[model samples]
Target: MSRKLLLKAVEQAYSDRRRLVAPLLGFPGINLTNSSIKVAQQNYIEHYKVLNALYNEFHPDAMFTLMDLSVEANALGCYTLFPQEESATVLHSSFDESRLEFMNSIEIEGDSRALSYCATVKKMSENFQDSMTCAYITGPYTLAGLILGANKAAEMTLTNPELLDDVCGTAYEKIKTYAEMLTSSGAKAVCVLEPSAVMLGPEQFIRFSAEYVKRITEIYSESDIAFIYHICGNSMHLLEAMCDAGVNALSLDSPETGMDIKKACKSAGDNIIVIGNINPAGKILYGTDDEVFNETEKLLNETAEFPNFVLSTGCDLPQAVPLENIRAFMDAGRKYKLP
Candidate 1:
């Protein structure tokens, strides 16, 4: 498929005031009894197979890479605590002034789940080249938090700004490399998940998080591929900073951030292509079908004027979310009319 296809599709969606649905559906499963890094690598094919199955089953407007934000952190030498049935978390941070000194030399080589992530993304692109394919990565600051410990990393933003910025730069390079890999495999865009940015106020975020996020997005500015920025938590305050980062789209957790999508976009002008605020855990995962439909219907009604608005969750959908709820969410979007 032509690279321009996705760029054109998005452009047209905005021009026509046609809302597109691309929820962050990247879960491998919710029922895994055991999901060690070893098990994932050994059964990489099966993992991608399940991912593909979900995509086909739901057939969302767009598809994203698997839910594995820890892959890059693990590759960067941070130990991960893989859960029996959940996404892995960064268990140990392997960063310090010394580690930062040689960060430029670090590469995601052998026996790394980062490689598995790339392989799965490659296969997804190959299988769904005609559609808009996206790859997910931990945003620089978030990855830095994972590698340097969230509290310590946050403190560095205040006391050791230079060191934090430097470490974030290291993460920037690594994320850019991962983005390149995904694009090479067929991803038309990359979504940088930076949930940690919410830990800081807008001023600190601009310096510590947004700056580095911009660096990664800038790398693809002139290219056909786009970049989408997602920050978990209430991001109403950082909407301007996120837009200034020059990402093609800004994905927000509406319920968490208390952001009125249309209100924020109006203040942000027409450039902000907002993606979400749907309560993934609250409504889509645990709420009744009527609640899910009402929320989806409400969001659609709210953002009907903004063609740049795409309906999606505030973040990646949880593995345990009910498939019936997901279908209900999708159905709501499909059933809405632009009257």
Candidate 2:
């Protein structure tokens, strides 16, 4: 399908409150068994079938690639081990800043896993050709966390600003390359997963993360592919900086970032979409279906004035989230129509 049609369907589905099912569509912090992860990789066709079944049951309009963190990090010199019955974990880093000179010389694609991720993008494109398939790229800031260690990166932001710049720059280059690969491989949109930027104050976020994000989005600005920036914490302070980054969409976790996002988008005169503020863990993951439906309705109603909003969890749905609860989200989307 054309990218135009894909986006239109997504908008229509959301507007009419129709369900749009996308696999690995958004982050769900829920853990999957190693076996499930392996199964997802080895039998994608089969996995697509399962996703289709869910979509059929729920009547969602789009599909997303299964969630996997191995792609970008592994490409940039991180190792991930998928445990059979446990959550996948990063086992090691290829470059450590303590040895800054050595890390600087390590090229992104020079790492074997990066090549594998490029291949995965091709495979996923072929697998989800009929639906709107979104490819995930680690946000430069988030990738910095993986490379420098979240705690180390946070500390360096204040104590060693230069080091923070070096680390973020290196990771941004790698993520930009990966984003290009995914877009070329037919991803309808690229979701920049920047959960860590929320940790910084507004000034720090602008200094450290905003420019890198802008750099990435600028590369894809002329393309039909969408650039989505997801900041998982209370980013009310950095909302304008994020909007200025030139993303096609801004995803926030709840409680609402308020009129700042609406005002920022207006100020920029850019048609950026807004997504999510639902409590993925608390409401969607563990709450009753009724709770999910009610909360979703509340969010939709509150954001109804915004034409480009997409309803979604504040973060990823837990791996073991009740399928029924997920269905409730879709159901609520279909039930709430804009006036």
lDDT of 2 by residue, 1-339 (tens): 123443465567656754333323432212222235455533444445544454445544445555555556655556667675343456545455665555455666555444544555565557554556666677777777777778878888889999889888877777787777677767777778888788888788877888998988776666677777777767777777888887777766767534243453354342666666677667777789999889888867776666666666666665677777887888887677776
Kindly report which residue stretches of model 1 are placed more than 4 angstroms away from their true locations once superposed. 1-7, 14-17, 28-43, 93-95, 109-111
Question: How far in Å is the alpha carbon of 144 misplaced in model 1?
Answer: 1.3
**Best lDDT among the predictions, by candidate number:** 1
TM-score against truth, every candidate: 0.90, 0.81
Candidate lDDT values, in order? 0.75, 0.65
What alpha-carbon RMSD in Å does predicted model 1 have with respect to the real structure? Answer: 2.9
Worst 10 residues of 1 by lDDT: 28-37
Off by over 4 Å in 2: 1-35, 38-59, 91-130, 256-270
**Candidate 1 global lDDT:** 0.75
